[model samples]
Target chain A: MPTRILKKSWFIKSIFFTSAFIILLIGGITYRNIDDLSKSSELLTQTYRLNVELEQIFSHLKDAETGQRGFLITNDPLYLEPYDAGRENINYSFAELKELSRNNPTLQKNLKDLNVLIDERMDYFQKAFRFSAVGNYNDQNFKENFYKGKKLMDTIRLKIKGMIKSQNDLLKKTQHTYESNLKVTPIFLYMVLLFSLVLMFFAYNKIIRDLKEIKASNEQLEIFKESANQSQIISQHGNWIWDIDTNTFKYSDNLYRLLGEEPQSFESTVENFMKFVHPEDAEKLSREIEKMITNKDLPFVYYRIIQKNGTIRHFKGYGKLHESSDGGKKLLGTITDITDEIDNLRILEDRNLELERNNRELSAFNYVASHDLQEPLRKIQTFLSRLEDKESSKLSEVGLTYIDRIKNASTRMRLLIDDLLQFSRTNRADNVFEVSDINELLESAKQDLAEIISEEDAIINSDKFPKINVIPFQIQQLFLNLISNSLKYKSKDRIPEIHITYSKIKASDDPEILKPKKPYYHKIIFTDNGIGFDNEYAEKIFVLFNRLHNKDEYSGTGIGLSICKKIIENHQGFIFANGKPLVGATFTVYLPIT
Target chain B: MQEDYINIILADDDEDDRLFFTDAFDELRITTNVKTFNDGVYLMDYLNNEESIFPNVLFLDLNMPRKSGLECLKEIKQTDKFKDMAIAIYSTSASEEDIEKTFVMGANIYIKKPNDFKTLKKVLSEVVTINWQYHTNGLNKDNFLLRL
Candidate 1:
């Protein structure tokens, strides 16, 4: 389907067609009027000729009568001569009238009667002249002849008058028709002219409208081109097309701007384009381009380019191979100056490396503090023990008390350091995730605290555990810390009974509990009948070095729960603790079942 | 002449640790003779000497100045002469990497050096009393790391 241009040709075509039709119509009307006028003129000329012939005939008959009357009264030869000339004139008029009315039956009949009358009248005239020449003063037959002549003249006058009246009527009818035809032709012509003018007006209006529309469209196209160029400049993008048949390339002005060159400054050949690429990337780019053109397979290419200003920039170019309408290959593509993006990525990578280094240094510090720091503290305690064992009797009471205090403080320091080590180890541990049997992890955790379990007479009731993908060692440590915490903080009135139960919960079922949103999680709850703190300290207990009870009340460095929290997090899971002052505490761990 | 008595050796760079270790053994009243080396090199030299008797239990400290306990453990396990010697990594560091490495290197046992003298005594007694043949025959990573 062809696209519809803003300027419509159909309007112009319609106008042309209407103009032609109107001109043809006007020509036809003029032609028709001229034809009708000519026909009416012919009819008028025939009527006029017939009327002239009738008038001549009537005049001649009157002259013959007058001449006959004179010749009879005085018996004169001049009168007789007038009668002879009238007779010849009447005969010529009658022949001309007959010839004029030959094609008309009615006119021919009238002329025949008029001719008989004329002949009779001439005979009467002759008789009168002869009778008078015989010298008869008065004759009865002559009077009768004069009476006949008078009557014949009257009859001839009436027939001539009738013919002239009929001719006059025909002329009047033809003239009326010619006048009406002239008036009607002009009115019809004016109507046709008015229609043509209207058609011309409509055609002209449509043509002007189409021209205006075309102008507006051209203006819009100019604005569109400017905006496209502006957008390309802003986005650091430029488009190009490579025509294989012509072996020529068309580059948008922005492409030249991207290369730090004036438009049309550089020749657009493959080798010339490669010259702009960074030396290290040029060969690979050349090979890739060669492969793309040979195989007609275009893939995205990202490389470094050296601009005309000697600045290195990263460019990402991608195009598609297409067959032009003329069976020639063409590649149309866009190139983006991705230097800023590359810089950002490099900065991110550098920051990541720095962060990893910081992490390594921090773990190193933890290991050193855990191990090396213990050496001196252990020495102090050991030598103190030796001093106490070897010289207890010599020491005073205050000295012994001071020594015990020092030992106690050092022991607490050792425990704190050990807990700190455990806390840091969660992050420093191996990151290999495997499918480990939770039952075995729990069993090992139980074995680790077997001595305390038996000594405290703690009853550990646990449900069967499911196997899960996790860092087994970290999970074991997590279990150990929670269980040890329960035993250490057991209620005084009862044997410590810790219930370990776990159930798999879907993310849809327990949205609040599994906050991080995994498909499946093991909600392992460790509910103990041990000394629990206020519920307000539930979140606080998970914080490093956050102790709910006094040191004397709970023998802990307060790092145990924090280590548990870290371990659970390592497995991409969540840990929560709930406690009440006298009631037991429950530590719930959510581990993803993956 | 003294085959019945337990012979224990400790290799440590820290003089106080060596003193404390020997004192702990002395206080325990176990039927044993204890010897101490300042570093791993000295300990290795003493064990290689044909004139010297092989200790029933050898306590190797991981972080010594001359040579690391892991390197010594590797050397001893490779040497046929030290096959009868029961190797124990007694270091203040309880890092899993150290323990695993020492275990893989054929160390008989791993113990984190305790802060209190009583813990040290208890750990040493338990280690010294272990049936070396039986322990070595069934040595596993699980039983290798001995926590005090």
Candidate 2:
């Protein structure tokens, strides 16, 4: 359908061309008509001149005839002189008329007839004049010549009149033709001029309308280009299209701007685009592009580019293999400047490393302080006890009391140091969590505290426990501390009874118990019938160095529960306690199964 | 043949540790002759001397100023002279790495230095009464590292 419309428009254009060609052809015809009209006018002038010369020749013959008649009657030479001059003039006019009439066949025939009649008349006149010039008296001959001359003169007059009448008709016909041709030439020229003017007006109007349409479209194109450029700059993302088969490249305006280059600075080609790429990245980028094409998969890549001003910038680009409308493979993608993001990531990684190093150093410091500090205190207690035992008899009561105080202080210091060391060592130990039976660990803890349990008369009971992945030593320590805690805080009036029960629970079943959303956990609850503190101090009991009773009332450094809490946390679990005044406390520990 | 009394050797850098150790042994009422050395260097010198009497049991202190207990243990285990002797690592540290290392090096026992003299006496008396042959025959990691 479009082709048909195009053909129709072509036809219309050809019509205009044909009209112009026709106008040119008509103008040529008008020019030819004007030339014909001029030639006709020139012919009419020549015919008129011939007729005038013919009349002159006829008059000269009449003059010669009259002179001859006079000379014959009076036999006078003066009359013969007039005849001679008429004869000479008639000959010259006749030759001129014949020369002018040569181009017209009809006039040439008439001139020939007139020339014959005038010659006969001229012969008769000459004969009469010759007799008069001789001075001879020939009356009879002269009388005969006179009658003959009169008859010949009558014939010559008739012939000359007929010839003159014919020449007058020819001249009138030529003049009419000349007048009509002169009148038609201007009308023909005007018609051709009017036709050309109309065709030219139509062509000029069409051109003006087309020019206006072109101007409007050009304005729209300029607006489109301006908006495209603005959006490219705003996004900091530029597009590129490369045709592999044709080796042609088209880069967006922002792409050139990003590379710090002017538009159209050079041809947009792969090699030219590569020139801006940093030398270090060029080979890799080229290889990636090749791989992308062969693999038929688009991959995102990050690379560095050296701009025209020699500033290095990081760019992230991705491209896909696109089959263009022409069935040729094309790479079309966008490049974004990612230098800021890369720098931010680098800084973040560095900070993370520094933090890890500081944490490790701090843990080491704790371990060293706790472990090394205990040595001196142990020695002091050992020596002080020895001194009191070996030299008590010689020392005064004050000295003995001072020695006992020092011994007590050193022992307390030693306990505190040992507890701190255990607390720090929990974090410093190599975290190797293995599948361990909690029941076995409990039994071992029981054995470790067998003497204390027997001395305190504490009853320890528990349900069957499950196996879990945990650091065995830490977990064992946890069990020992809790059991020992129960023994330490036992009621004076009754023997302590500890009931331990464990049940498996999901994170969803008890959301408040586990912060991390693990699938399963072993919720081991230790309910001890001991001298429990107020419920408000339940959380405080787990804090390091937070004791419910004074050092004299309870023998503990107050670090046991905190170590248990630390151990549970290391296994990604939770430990919490609930206590009521004069009632037993319930300590629950959650250990993830996996 | 069974000896009349057990011969025990202790190598430690601290003066107080040596005194506390010998005092604990004296009060323990054990039939044992206790020998003391200031550092692993002196202990190694005494052990390597051809005329010196080898002890029935050797207690090595780990963190010494010169010649660490680990170095001394390595040297003693390499020699055939100290083959019949029971080696024990007695240090202030109960670190797993130290225990495992000494255990692998064929040390019969590891003892964390006791804080109180009473506990120290009990640990020393228990260690002395143990039949060396039985302890060496049934040697395992569970019964190797002892903490008091």
Relative to the real complex, the DockQ score for model 1 comes to 0.52
lDDT of 2 by residue, A398-468 (tens): 99889888877787887898898888788725778889998999999999999999998788889998678
Residue B140 of model 1: what lDDT? 90
Clashing pairs in 2: none
DockQ of predictions, in order shown: 0.52, 0.46
| Highest TM-score model number | 1
DockQ versus reference, model 2: 0.46
Where does candidate 2 stray beyond 4 Å? A1-239, A252-267, A279-302, A308-311, A316-319, A333-338, A509-511, A514-516, B1-9, B22-37, B41-55, B79-84, B118-130
Q: Could you give the C-alpha RMSD of every candidate to the true structure, in order shown?
A: 7.9, 13.5
Please, what are the lDDT tens digits per residue for candidate 1 over residues A432-540? 8889998999999999899899999999989998678888888899889999999999999999999998888886788556355578788889999887888888899
For candidate 1, the TM-score of chain A alone versus the native chain A is: 0.68
The per-model lDDT (C-alpha) reads 0.83, 0.81
Interface RMSD of each: 1.4, 1.3
Runs of candidate 1 exceeding 4 Å displacement? A1-227, A264-267, A270-275, A283-298, A454-463, A490-501, A506-515, A528-531, B1-8, B24-34, B47-56, B118-129
